[model samples]
Target: MSHFTQLRTKITELEHLVAALADVGYATVETHDEARPLRGYQGDRRRQRAHVIVRRQHVGAASNDLGFERQEDGTFRAWISEYDVRELGAGWLGRVEARYAYHATRATLARQGFSVAREETDRDGTVRLVLTRQATGF
Candidate 1:
């Protein structure tokens, strides 16, 4: 028996979520306007609307489907089978979120003509990113 688990996330933009997934090596395919149920092993399914479907190839042999649903509040939530969580490790969400943040921040800064000046990761898993913009003298 497979049950759909709701993994709450702070991702509002679908592009950011997709980028995050790609960053983590999950190939995603965009679905249509209507939400489709994610099929699972043993005929388990969820009647949820998923904007993007993360292909099952990442989880080989399992019928577990992973997708993202948009909430009324505009944030997106992860809809995945419980089996995937167990197989993909409990830190899956964290890893995705970290990537999302990384991409989002980089995009935001790039739009403002800022580039990464320095990047470093500490022993405590803290990342320090320094941004810089070209100086234009009037």
Candidate 2:
């Protein structure tokens, strides 16, 4: 494939991963140090293997609703917000926080939707997975 196609595929794979995360009640991202203390979930720092991270019900000054950005320092950021969350969060994502991420990614990927083939709930109550994609007519 061409370079652009490869890049698009990579992006879609990453988006799919994130959308799958949203289907549950969690995401895989981090926030700025300044924004960190504001979170309700000051989650465990140990054993998180992260490249791109998710932030639900958390936002920043320059954030776009359900925004995606890559820092020069190489962190991938993804999120859902109050406004967009209500529109996309659904089905498995039954909570307010989950719904926000669902709706946010839904609009961001009009032609594509997320997939959840597997969900493993750890002893710590964290869900890890290998997500795919699907086409929903709703």
Candidate 3:
């Protein structure tokens, strides 16, 4: 039986999601055009699938694959096992969310011709970004 449970998130962009995972130290995340099966704790493939996956090997010896499945609403939801949640801590997803927000904001700003003039991270893992845009005409 699969122990994975789906958790809703506000993530909508794939590129930003991948970059966010990388920022959180998951550099080997796999992305597929189609959903792929996730590996269980016993190394067996479960029916659960996702577009973005962090393999079981990367999670832990007894942990299942961590995944983000794209929903019909254009957002992505996380699929994580209960055991893995306990091992990875309850705040793990929060960290990923913060990083996702950071990347997404930066990308949006860049598209609007805004550049990061200053960036700071506090001891509590809060990120502060100061953006500046050039004047089109003076």
Candidate 4:
């Protein structure tokens, strides 16, 4: 039996989401143009599908696959098994979200010709970034 739970998230960009996963140590995440099936506890394919997936092998021996589906509004929704959630703990998602925001902000700033002048993280996991842009002469 499958025990996947759907969770909504504010992640709207696929590239940022992938990069965020990598930043959080999930380097082998799979991305597809269309949603693909997720595996269950027994390595059986479940009916649920997602555009971005972290395979069961990467999660744990007893854990099911982790997935993120793209929504109509361009955001992604997470589909994580209840078993995996307990294994990963509650803070797992929060960390991913925080990293997502970090990457998104950095990418946006880079596009605007801004460079990261300083970056730091507190003991409490709070990230601070300082950006600067070169002055253009007329």
Predicted candidate 1 versus true structure: per-residue lDDT over 10-53, tens digit per residue: 98877888888887777656654667777666445557558778
User: By summed lDDT, which 10 consecutive residues of candidate 4 come out lowest?
Assistant: 56-65
For residue 74, model 3's alpha carbon misses the true position, in angstroms, by 0.5
CA lDDT, every prediction?
Answer: 0.79, 0.38, 0.91, 0.91
lDDT of 2 at 121: 65
User: On residues 1-138, what C-alpha lDDT tens digit does candidate 2 reach at each position?
Assistant: 001000111132344445555555345444232323212123323222224344434433332223334434443333333433434443222333343444455555544555556767677545565567765578
lDDT, candidate 2, residue 54? 49
Give lDDT for model 4: 0.91
Alpha-carbon deviation at 9 in model 2, angstroms:
22
lDDT score of model 1? 0.79
* Candidate 1 segments exceeding 4 Å error: 42-45, 121-125, 136-138
Better of 1 and 2 by TM-score: 1
Please give the lDDT score at residue 11 for candidate 2. 31
Distance from true position, residue 55, model 1, in Å? 2.6
